[model samples]
Target: MKKTVFACDACGYETHKWMGKCPRCSGWDTIKEYKIEKEETQVHEKPLIVNDEDFIEEKIVLGMAEMDRVLGGGLVSGSSILLGGDPGIGKTTLCFEIASKMVELGHNVLYISGEESLKQLSLRKKRLNLQKPFSMLTTNRLEDILHAIRETPYNLVVIDSIQSTYNTSLPMLPGSIGQIKDVSSNLIMEMKRADMAHIFIGHVTKEGVIAGPKILEHMVDTVLYFEGDKMLPYRLLRAIKNRFGPVDEVGIFQMSKQGLISVENPSQFFVSERSNIGSGSTLFPYITGSRPIILEVQAITPKTNFSIPKRISLGYDSNRLFIIIAILEKVLGKPFFDRDVYVNVTGGMKVNETAIDLAVAASILSSYKDINIGKNTCLFGEIGLTGEVRKVVNMELRLKECGRLGINRIFCPQGVEGVDSGVAGMEIIPLKNVKELNSLAFSK
Candidate 1:
C-alpha cells in the first residue's frame, strides 16, 4: 500500500495513522489525514502586470456618513461587508436607511430579503414614514438572485440574511456551513464579475455571535456589528473589522416609529438628565468606542444576601467593578467589602477605555462616601494599584470636547505635562490619588 500521512483538518496535529481523537486542537471526530497525488503542470498563465491607471475603477458612495466612514470613505467596487446583529436591534432599519440614501443618489440597490416579503418590507418602510423608492426583491434561492443581479445593472445588492437564503445547487439548508461557504463564495465571484457592491446580512446567535462558520467573517472585506441595548430604542453600528476605517469607529442611531435617526453628539444624549449633587450617582465622561460621552455611574453598597457578596456591574465588567471597589477601599478610605456592590453606567454603553477608570473609581467612592463630584465637572483617567492615577490618551482633545460642550471643570490624571493652563482656559484639576478627588468632591 502506497499512502502518505497528513494533519487533521480540525486539529493541526500530524498523524501517521488517522485516529478518532485530535491531540492538538481537541476537535472531536475531526482527524482525517490524506495523501496528495502528484500531477503534472499543464498551463503557464502570465500574471497581469498592474498599473495605477490601467483600469478605470468606479466606486459607489453609500451616502451615510457613518456607513461610508466604516467602509473606508466609500464602497470599493465588488467588495462585500457582513452585517450582523441581534433581532429587532434596528439592523434592517439601518439597512433600509442605507438603501434609501443610495437610491436618492441615483444608485440602483437590490434589497433581497428572505426574512421578509416585498409587502412586509414596504410595511416596515411605511411605518418608518419613508417615501424613497428602490428595488426590493424577495427570494430565497441564491442562484435566482444571482441571475437577477446579472440581468440587471445594479450598483449594489444587499442580502437581508445569508442564513435564510438557500442555494438550490447545495444539498444542505441555507444556514449550514457548507451552504454559507458555497453561497458566499459564489456571490463574491459574481459580484466581482459584475463589479457590484454587496452587503450580506447575517443573523447572530443568542450569545451575540454571528451564526454560521467563522470563516464567513474572514471572507468578507468588512464586518459591521449593530450593537446596542435592545431594551432601549437606540442602536450603534460598530465596525469590528474594517479594511479602510478604524475598527473602533461607531455610529449611533435611535429607532423610533419613524426609523433610525442619527444621534448627533451622543455624549449629550447620554448624560443630560443627571441630577446634580446626588448620593450614589456621579457624572463623568466615558470613552465609548473612541467617542467621549458623559455618563452617570451609580454604585450601591447594600447588605449582602450571600456569603460572598455579589458584585453586579451593568454595562461593564463585574471584575472591574470589584477591582475599583478594592482600590477605593484601600486608597480612598471607602468601605464596601461586606456589602453587595452594584455599579451601573447609564445609557447602556459599555466603556473599557482606560480613561474612564478614574471616573468610575470616583463615582463608586462618591456613592460610598456620600460626596458629590460636582455638577459641571467631568473626570477621566486610568488608576494603578499603587493609587497613582495614570494619564490617558488624547487628554487635550477630551478636555477640548468637554469645554466645547460647556463642561466647566475637568479632572485629569496627574503628570499631564505640556497642557498649559488657559490653552483652552478650562480648569484642569489634576489628581494623583482617589484621596485628592475625595477631598475635592467633599470640599467646599
Candidate 2:
C-alpha cells in the first residue's frame, strides 16, 4: 500500500504527513491529501515550430483610460485576467461596461454567467442601458460554455464567476480547490490555444483574499482586485499581478445609479469638502498608480477615563498609527499613553504608503496641542524611528497634485529641493526630521 501526499491549497506546500496547520503559509486546515495513480508512457510527436510573424504584439484597447491604465494599456490577446472582489462591489458593472465598449468597437464578446439567469442578466443590461451586440450565455455546465465559445467567433470571453461553473464529469464540488484548479487550467489552456482573451470573475474570502486555490491567481496572466467601501461611492481597481503591465497601477471609479463612472479628477472629488485650517486636519498628497491625489488626514486625541485608552483607526493601519504615536512620544517628550487617538483618511481610501507618515504625525500632534496646521500647506514624507524624515518616490508628482489643489506650502524630504513646483507661487519647504513639524503647528 502507498501513502498519499498532502498539499497546502493556499501556498501549495506539500508534505508526506498531514498536519492540523500548514507550517509554510500558517493556514489552518488548508492541507488536503489526494491519491496519485501511475500512468503508462505514451508516444511523443515532434511539434511544428511557428514563425515570429505569427505572434502579434498589438493589444486591444479597453477604451476606458482608467481600466487601460490598470491593464497596462488594454487587454492582451490570449491573456487570462482574474478579477476578484466582494459581492455587489461593482465587478459585474465594470465587466459589462468593458463588454459594451468592446462590442461597440466591432469586437465580438461572449459573456457567460453561471450565477444569474438570462432574464436577470437582461434586466441588468437594460438598467445599464447597454445596447451593444455582444452575446450572453447563462449556463453552469463547463462543457456547454466551452462548446459555445468554440462555435462562436468571439474575440473576448467573460466568465462571470468561475466558481459557479462546474464540470459534471468530475465528482468534486464546483468551488472545491481541486475542481477550481482543474476548471481554471482547462479554460486557460482553451483560451491560449484559441488565441482569445478571457476574463474570470472570482469571489473573495472574508479575509479579502481571492477564494479557491491560491494557484487560481497564478494560473492567470493578470490578477485584479476591485476594492472599495460599499458605504462610499468611490471604487478602486488595482492589479496586484500583471505579466504584461505595471502591477502598481490602479483605476478609480465612482458608482452611480447608471453604472460605474471613471473618476477623472480624483483630487477634487476627495478634497472637495476638506476641513479648513484646524486642529487634527492635515492635507497629504497620495500617489495612486501613476497619478497623484491630495487627501486629508484627520486625527483626534481626546482624554480618556478608561484605564486602557482606545486606539481607533479608519482607512489607515491601526498598528502603524500606534507606531507613529510611539515615535512622537519618544521624539517630542510628549506622552499620549492616557489619551484615546483616532485616525482617519477622509476619502474612504486606504493609504499604506510610508510617505503619509509626516501628515499623520502632524495631524495627531495638532490635535494633542489643540493647534491647527495651515490649510494651504500639504506634506508627505516617511518618518524613521530616529525622527529623521525620508524621501519619497515621485515627489514632483505629489507637489504637482498639491499645486492643482491650490496648496502653496509643501513640506517634504530634503532631497526634493530641485523639483519644479508645477503650481506657480508654490513654496517647497524641506524637513530633515519629525521635530521640525512643530514649527508648522498653530498655537492653541
Candidate closest to the true structure, highest lDDT: 2
Instruction: Judge candidate 1 at residue 134 and give its lDDT.
Output: 85
Candidate 1, which segments miss by more than 4 Å at Cα? 1-46, 55-61, 275-277, 288-290, 420-425
Model 2 poorest ten-residue lDDT run: 36-45
Per-residue error (Å), model 1, residue 377? 1.7
List, residue by residue over 1-444, the lDDT tens digit for candidate 2: 444678776665678898989898798998888765444676576888999998777688978888999999998978899999999999889999999999998888999999898898889988988888679999878899889978976788999998888877554567766668778898898888888889999999999999888888888999999999899998999999999999888788999988989888888888888655578998999987788988899999999888999899987888888889999999888898799999999877788799999999989988999887778888899999889999999999899888888889888999887788777788888998888877645444
Off by over 4 Å in 2: 1-54, 275-277
Clashes of each: 0, 0
The local lDDT score (0 to 100) that residue 394 gets in candidate 2 is 92
Q: Residues 1-444, candidate 1, lDDT per residue (tens digit)?
A: 335664455423566887777676677776655564444656566888899998775556766666675566777767788999988787788888888887888888889999998889999888877677888899889988988998997878999889888777444546766577778888987897787888899999988889988999898988999988878878888888877567877777787888887787787887767745576776666654456667777777777878898888887677767677888778866667577878888877777676777777776666666676677778888888877788887776677667767777887887766664434556788898777877876555
TM-score of each: 0.85, 0.89
